[model samples]
Target: MHRVLDILATEDGDVSEVVNRFRDIENTALRTAFHNCAVLLRMLEAQAGLTPTWEGGPGAETQQAVASNTKSTDSSPPTKNAPKRRFTPQELQPFVDETQRGKVSVAKVYVDGASRGNPGPAGIGVALFTMDGKKIAQISRAIGTTTNNAAEYTALIEALKLAKDLGIQQLYVLSDSQLMVNQMTGRYKVKHPQIAEFVAQAQELAKQFAKVSFHFIERENNRLADALSTAPIAKIPNQRTDSSSQELMALLDDNPDEGRTE
Candidate 1:
């Protein structure tokens, strides 16, 4: 509602057209807002050199019909105290426009994992960059205390997941973890049982793509991924000081696979 108000206040060539556009909103409180704020919007319109239509403005009859059907007794304006309405798939199409994402079938994924200690607080960062070097999205969050190796594999898993979400087919995964890169590329054997599981999980996700290649990147070149992985550490207290707090902090991000320990 606030965003709509801001848009109405904008000096468009035909501000009334903008006002008429939203009048068809079926949401009671939303439509009510447009009706109650009728005078204010007209004043705004006139202030910008546009003619003000206060009495029986465009869509006034529709607003009157909606207002009479409203069941709420309270006359107070709506507040954003309730959960936001979820958008239907059709409503999401506008956001999928070129401004949000271009035709991106190939992308470079940079992933890095950070841990305060060998088996302390961990976080993973995955940055998706298009072939033209445009960074489209990022994933950054603190994971509960876990080994550095587990976090590295988790980062790769996340990178693949993000790629799949974006419908990316060809992926060039760049990481600063040499051991992880070597293992994923078949240069080194996975001796650690736990890490082997991580490699297995990553391989399964990798199969979803047309091509997924791992490459060793210099730590200097992987600054964005490094920063993303470690960014959560400072936001949460050290595990040694408050393990409970760290656990709570980890809950802030939505994790689909919960209770999966490292």
Candidate 2:
């Protein structure tokens, strides 16, 4: 600690000098200690909401020019890294149109899971509808800390359970998450052990229904479910699950996915 402080105080916070000093240290234990100290300092800086500055070397000018060019292009198409635009809940609806030949008695279920920080406070949302497009039930619940994938699986599981309780025999499951949909349909393998457990649970619940089909939809087609899954109630400390669920259910029921296909 003292050595790092000394280096900062004497070297005017020159990270390069500290880097050089650590590079010169031959003792493995001392080097490890320095590494830990550096990591701690970085974590502290992050906690303080500090914008880290880097001393960009020779390519700094080139990088800046590229950035300026990207910013200057007014009519250019979006880059691969552009932020995705979300659809309003009103815009989401079943992919199948009313004009479709036959409307089976299967219940349509749209499920979504949201995580603020991927592994942060998470929530699951499920919207159910009868074959003729009558909204029947909705379920949303905050599941505390979990990954998006976990929340996605949880949403499906809860939806399956709800369908079972409703005595639903046929279910058409829909999700915006291609990964979750693919995994459920056996198109993709569940590589993670935790995800495998969730999949197994969902499978067991699915057995209650005579037939359950998984389908992948685009984000725009899943607005209602997405909105419920990412609702603000999930972030409240000591939040009431029932209240959150009710709020989400209301939102889902009122904001029926409608309009023309994108």
Candidate 3:
């Protein structure tokens, strides 16, 4: 099931190819695993308001059942909604002040992560700069879905990898996700099973740096990374290409110091 989820998360390769690749396994176990994963994927798709059509095949009936379950789950939500709470400006002032204090920095490296349909298409974005406000590097790549935090850590890991590749010894990493920053800095506990491995990978990479520090930043300040993270995937041939081109140009322009030779 995990293998199927991994493949589905990538959203690459032909579905038939995937099924064929798993054909070596015993039929009963394979069908069980595939159906289980398909069920979960159908649920995720439903949450994203996508209706999947399964053409008649070995697992077609099971897929239909999963889709039906998804529809029922969607229709059953919230007979009566829970009340919402609002925070007053005065009450939020202290936290705002703390955030402002946290933003005090000459240079900031902003990183962000994005996932399409939550556990579906995922990507990571990173932007780095100097203390004097010189733009350094901006990078974004599609990484397939797992989770938001996984993508976040992957972004940070990629940033660190790039920094090391560029011979950067000292850096101040900044991200909008406090959980990620705090966990990396050993200030917070990493209890989530999904993120533990990624956190360990980040920690392992950190050891190679001469000096590395992490700080949390407001989402507004981290807009470049956020934009890159949320940028839509380009569809080839039939669709318009200009939008993705512009986004790529903007990302490139945001950081001029990329690949600079010391």
Highest-scoring model, lDDT: 1
Cα deviation of 192, candidate 1, in Å: 1.3
lDDT of each: 0.64, 0.62, 0.56
Q: Which stretches of candidate 3 lie over 4 Å from their true place?
A: 1-108, 232-262
Q: Is candidate 2 or candidate 3 better by TM-score?
A: 2
Output the TM-score of candidate 3: 0.48
Candidate 2 CA-lDDT value: 0.62
lDDT of 3 by residue, 1-262 (tens): 3344343332221243354355546778767877799789878856754333221121223434555455344542221121223323332221112222223222345688875544446777776554434445667667854456667888898888766655555566878777787678776666656567888888888798766778775564465676656553322122333456544543442232432332
Candidate 3 Cα lDDT to native: 0.56
Instruction: Indicate the TM-score of model 1.
Output: 0.54
Alpha carbon RMSD to native, model 3: 20.6
Flag the better candidate by TM-score, 1 or 2: 1
Clashes of each: 0, 1, 0
Question: Which sequence of candidate numbers ranks them by TM-score, best first?
Answer: 1, 2, 3
**Candidate 3 — worst ten consecutive residues by lDDT sum?**
91-100
- Worst 10 contiguous positions by lDDT, candidate 2: 51-60
lDDT of 2 by residue, 8-108 (tens): 43322224345446666898889898899978976764543331222111122233335445544343222222344464545333232333223333567
